[model samples]
Target chain A: MTGPGRPAAVTGIGLAVSGLGTPDDLLQPDGAEEAFDPATGLTGRAMRHKDRASRFALRAAADALRDAGLLTGATFAGPASRTCVVVSTNFGNLDSVCTFADTIAEDSVLGLSPLGLPHTSSNSVAGWLAIEYGLRGPNLTVCNGGTGGLDALFWARAMIAADRADVALVVGVEPDTAPVARLVGHRPRLDGAAAVVLESVPHRRSRGAPPRAVITACTHGAALPDAVRAVRGTDRQPVGLWLTPAGPRPGDAASSWCATTRDLTARLGECSGALGVLQCVAGVSYLDASGPGAVLATSADGPDHTAVAALLLTAPGQAS
Target chain B: MSCVITGMGAVAAVGGGPEQIFTALCAGTSGLTKLRAFDLNRYRAHHAYEIDDRTGPGRDEPLRATRWLVDAVEQACADGGLTPAARVPVLLGTTLREQRSVELWWRGEGEVSAADLHFGPALRRRFGFTRTYTFANACAATLYALGLATDLLDLGMADAVVVAGTDAITESAFGTLDRVQNRTPEALRPFDRARAGMLMGEGASAVVVRRDGDGDRPALARIRGVSMNCDAYHPTAPDPAGIAAAMHAAHTRAGLGPDEIDLVMLHGSGTELNDAAEATALHAVFGDAAARPLMTAIKSMTGHTLGGSGLLSLIVAVLSLHRGVVPPIAGLTDPADEAAGLRLVSGTAATAPLRTAQVDAFGFGGINAVAVVERS
Candidate 1:
């Protein structure tokens, strides 16, 4: 097991999103088409075939890889370096699944799209990533409603700790479809995605890479606060924070605790699984400036529910 | 770091639990019978190993597959002398969540409810477990669950973990299979030149996992290692190269070479493609040793229980270790497929002390899992 104090460094990241298919596009939002939502906090170009979930995941994964400077071939140690990918989704292509149901209704035993059947699966994104990057180690797609993203991160940390993979890609994506919106009994909101590349602290130190934020601990389920207290003890120097859509807003006494994109999107009735990625991006964006010790919490309400809390501790001297 | 299998339970076409199923398997009694669980009027092949429909304490409810899974876990925990209230983590694997319920909902016979989606949570609640997870990786789900549980235990995540899987063939999924042309009406003939498609079966299996510790049971067996790999070749078809990632990883983790494997429990679903591909993969790993290891397929008796097949096969492997007997590969008569090379046990059971065994499970989405077990 990874020791309590020993950090798991975010060494490489990748993300892709709506209106911004690459990191360059996300970094310079003006370069792409204006993607904004007045009802919800989501802003992106609308595509018929590409739903909010896919758009969120694509962007988040691309940006995460870019943030860690892993997009280009020059960043990798070698072709053989083991990389694992874990993507989380709350609804898991709810749009496609609903569509499959509709198709079955229309043609009792006749026609069903071959492509749509596979696309509706929760692991479609993980399968896409594995095929896209040739990542052959430990690909997993986890669904725990709101905590999906945080759970993915936790699993990635475990994989790294177990020496299963050298670098891990953790992505979370959610969709804002009408069916999803209706199911959640909310209006559509902007869907989002986030990706984080994690590695052992020693490997990051050896690579001479700029000290990235270290994940000290993660807590899940209803007893998250207890787990968080157990991990953090009395230290409370968080400069910026992100909370789940339903999480209570942190008091003003703390530093900047901005509401996540999910909080905005959930209001607009979006059920996108990538909401956590957007929140993570926002959290990282804050920390990249003057923020430090940011905490992110993503919560989902469903039958198989979850709440994930992540603590990002900037390395000493690297705290912005 | 050897991971021990302290306890196991299973429900197959033959009967409920391991002993009953093994007895039926040894007797060469086929579990294939006319499908009476549901109305399959429009379907072609109707035979299935339908569990008795009894509920309330002793009855196998139509939804009893999941209930059976819980019972199996409870039985495994009891067999291992672990308290029911113990807070052991759980890892469950299945292809679909109560597929029968889904089919009923699809047919407009019932409402789409939380019970259909909350199978994992229901299991967690039934077992009173705090840390529980579910994996739906097609046929390789249970093996992956077992492998992950072992990994977690080795990493000191939990003292004891429960790995279980269940799947019940519902009419809708059966119809889908019929539409896809993947189901065979009559018998399952693995590695047979005249082999048709696979016959879908329904069943559940589970194993109690723990770190190698003090145990006096002479029948105990150890899980050395497990490996999973994705072909990325095709969503349904396996890589023709006979990708040996899973086999290699299992061998490496078990600290054993291919030559050391005494037996192989293949995922011989009786499908032409699956059997051939598995044969090729086995040959690639075992080389000249391929012809020596005793190879068998248990799917003929239990049917292809989708996600539960992996764990069910593992249970059979453990039983082999315990009983010192390897059952025959049921339907394969002639040596039609020489490419499978491995010694295909047939006719009757072979009594031999198996030092090490390998089990393989491959899913529809290019997911491949393999685990190595050794006599303790």
Candidate 2:
């Protein structure tokens, strides 16, 4: 693998999970609730036929821009052409897909709503995020396995490094609907969204936004140890903390490499698409509260997921 | 570092491989026929460009798109003369991925797991690819995936990447298209004066991309650049300004001017709005150039393969650049008024000393993606 490019600064964070007061709540031992209502703060006739995941995405994106000091009221404060959006959701729009299928089965082809058709397209969340905030730069949707969240963040970092965009609004959301439950066997999953404003150093500095954390490296590989090794590269200093999908096992190689390890899945339930962003938010919080440390975020390995994506986060102005 | 396509493969209604598809296009073959995926009764549109039973009949065996994808990827690997490596990443772009399988399960006609909705599980099991990324970026998904694949190579994340797009005709998308079009033409006639609307098609296309100097394989074509953007306009409507922006970005990144482009593969979904809007955008982008490129749409023959359409067009563009010939837009009785200044190839394949080409894919939600390719 090539050497890591210039670090990307995390300037803002947004959360829309049910019963969480803020992103910091993710660090708690338990969550408030397991279910979310899509109509909590979404209003107006524009949201008439919007799906639950799209609504969560819009809410989290707006909050992220606002948190980044790039949005005032309903207007975006940054250059629209240079700002992009990258969204991650494994099963975000299952409800809409199933609903449309049922509609066709119950009635006929003509019975389907034309307005509802766009949501069935998997990119609707990213499209809606861009349209709502007028982000005209590159737009993409990552719908892979559990690694999708980190994949989305890695894409944003790659885009910024390639000069495709100066700022990337990365959002990961998955809804807990009946159709999704039926397909996945009702395993408790996060029914909300988590977002982060990842920007180039110059862009963040120009806006005078304080960096919450700096992503020194992001790598994807066949396994977690290899990915973590790639992230660390030749740097021998062990990471201070590791926020992983599941807690470290007794014989895990990472536990010996890092000082502390926390299971994000156990603490926050099944975050799924929101896992990577939540890990970043928690990393920022940990660095802000403590001082001078690195946090590596990773997803759990599964038979369906043959890949592992890792993100290395360090405190502002600190080496990873 | 420059990215080049080492090998390419495609599976459409008209043909199975790149050479076969290109030959079929040069022969003005059309793949449109009566819709056999579902009951056509009570529907105004009764036709679609569908693959035959070679992959098995529709609905009876779900994951039809996955089958096509696997076939295309295997062909691409063989074409490149490269063995599957553990580090090779598979980047797949799809709209309605295996949603057809989900639909079958919803109707109690098949068994599908949540993991089966994507191609990762199937691909991992078959090829043992370590990392696979699936992008469901609507119709423009394939080109979008190409952009990421190029990035992965540039970033040294992988030695090479397998970029593929696959989609089967799903009932929901078909019903939605039927409702939106009101009536589907017997054949999709993109840019035609009497063109009605687009018909859904099923197929898969793949290309193995790597840094030019990284491997010893002969390069089929050089990928100059791939760019994508959101119109941030209406969800289902085409935006000329947005489309033009993506085209300009692609050209700028490729370091090529509009005059240098010899051919363009239009999105050309055969819909009235798409045709007019795409033509307008092309004019806006190439307005200052002295000679406009010869533009053609393969969807007129292959039909709209949705997510697979972009790479399908790109594969054809690569062949055109290599062969120095352009395929005709099949069944074009008369061109529309908006295509007045555009040089659209019709009737039969035309020869030109082509050096560079551009492929455009504009999708729902105003997602626009463009890619520039050149002869190796």
Candidate 3:
């Protein structure tokens, strides 16, 4: 229920990508890690038990929770029933599914590894995250192709708005299986995951958590006007423009009116599942210097007859 | 605002349409047959509740699941007096996407084409839908999709939304069943003494939901509320507490108390774990209440359709509420202790003044969901 002044506040961020180092490293020229492993942040039997995709999501989820201070001792404040997990992805654990299929084809179905059967689902990562963190709330996996990330964020916001959950964790993970990832036109090195923590304005303030920014609006469309109304008015100046890597560049006027364009795909590599959320987080960081920001993403559904668009507006949490 | 089920269609092992399915269930007809869609030499448990969904890739069918989906959507839209010209969105749920398509992809014969990804966009282009979505949350996916559809209608996002689900038995699923060793060599039985395992099942179902103020369209039943949550305990097993929590949440959201429910359709996959977990969940909620709703399991006839099972149960529940009869389990004997204090329909259909009913579904990955409906 975001209004003129009220918006959902972001308090935490976590990331796992092909690159090494840290979240900021993803923006650097040589950000892609030579051999970044999803098992780095996990431990014990879990690391051994899960697939690379689940491992990637687990690392990112842990980082996001830690950033939001939910991992340490935030449980005492909110009931597990008031917390939820929403995962966004286009193709679920393709690697494991393919492998499981191989085992079935080669060996007898009874000879296949039973433990590996669980990871073959589209929501396995979300289920594992819930089990690891004990977020026993509504678990959803939004898989509407490339638009999944923004849709997941919007879904989380809707959950909070509907009073379904007091706290929401939104994560997008895309683990590359060369064949499957290539279908979405992602590069081999684009294997990664990103997560954001969302809460109500009052909830953030009550927890004394410093706000990163306020997400004012998120909307999807079959199409949109060339110029957005969110960027109009002198007082409503935008700080930067965030665009999906494959998205077209904005007009000179729109670009100059805001900060430099932050091409998410360029910086993080073109990942279909993780691109939308990555762009949102990058916009938040870019807007930190000045004020608000806007991110626009579009995908061709079928000829020009059908198209999909996701637009998000963010404003500074602290008043000028 | 409330949502109502204006139209529903189901393609199960029993038959298509609520009346056909209801009649078959009443007559104790089971749909178990030898798996024929794919080569079953790679697995044990030769029997599966499978349909000869051979319409696909060519020969006017286009896709193996298209015929079942067509039957369901056509029935649902006709029942609701809805038309493709309205450009409504279709929200579909399935445990596994079209396995045939994926199998080819794995064998390097093809890739995950647009048609293989989701039924929504494809249906739109073919049937003139406004939008299409495919939810892949496994067993409880359809119930989840139902919840989302209800949310859309409640929010006025769409005047009428078509919630559908379809999945066909394939070599991969049968292989999984064989690996898990959760299939009954005896028979599909729920709450029975010899309820050893589940019988793999697959089919399709569709329902048309309209907003409360969408004119006097004569809804089949009023969709009171929907609740979906996860166990977070195990990947393939459901926690009874999680199941109870989902039911309680749905009740709270519908503004109804536990006593209001008079009938329930279970996830009962005919497996020991699923049945035991569901029974524990039921006991957790009812706690020996005098007016506890009679619990019924339809998997005895339809096997377990996985994601499609919940929506099938929903169609059956609607027909039961409308017809005033709870379809028997088809075949049941030697009730287990889990049947203690709870009425388990056996042999013949039971008649009751069922005003409120709930359809519960659980899936692999600890997915759990419930939908409550009241007589309109």
Against the true structure, whose TM-score is highest?
2
- TM-scores for all predictions: 0.84, 0.96, 0.90
DockQ of each: 0.23, 0.64, 0.43
Model 2 alpha-carbon miss at residue A199, Å: 0.3
**Which lDDT tens digits does candidate 1 get at residues B1-376?**
6678888888877778888888777666667777755444455565666555444332123355667788778777777665544247677777654545544444454445433342445654665564555566778888888888877787776777788888876544554454465445577777777666677787888888878873443336789898876665555667634257788888998899998999899898877778778877877778888898888888877888888899988888888877888878777777556544679888888888788999999876567789999888
lDDT (tens digit, per residue) of candidate 3 on B1-376: 9899998888987787778988888778888887664446776777778775554522112245655776788888888888875347677787666654666576675555633555645675567663566677788989988988887766556788898888765455556666786544546888887776777776789998998768456888999999988888888877888999998888887888878888989787777777788888887887756237877889888988877789999999988887889988855778887777777888788888899998899987787889999888
lDDT by residue for model 2 (A1-320), tens: 42337788988888887666566677767655543345566556555677888888888887788988999887889889899899998778777777777878778777888887787788888888888888899888888767788888888988888788999999998877887778767677677888999999999888789888888887767776777778876874468878887632424665667888787777556677678877887788788777446888887434434667788888888421
TM, chain A, every candidate? 0.74, 0.92, 0.84
Report the lDDT tens digits of candidate 3 across residue range A1-320: 11223367777788877655556555555645454555454455656678776777877777777887777653323456778888877665666656666777787686677777676566787888788777777788766665667767777776676666778888888776754654555454367788888887778778787777666665544433322333232355454554544544455656565565556666555465566676666555555544445544333243232434354546544631
Model 2: which docking level applies? medium
- Evaluated on CA atoms against the true complex, candidate 3 attains a DockQ of 0.43
Output the TM-score of candidate 3.
0.90
**lDDT winner:** 2
Off by over 4 Å in 2: A31-39, A247-253, A301-305, A318-320, B54-59, B288-291
Assess the local accuracy of residue A278 in candidate 2 as a C-alpha lDDT between 0 and 100. Answer: 76
TM-score for the A chain of candidate 3: 0.84
Model 3, A174: alpha-carbon shift in Å?
1.0
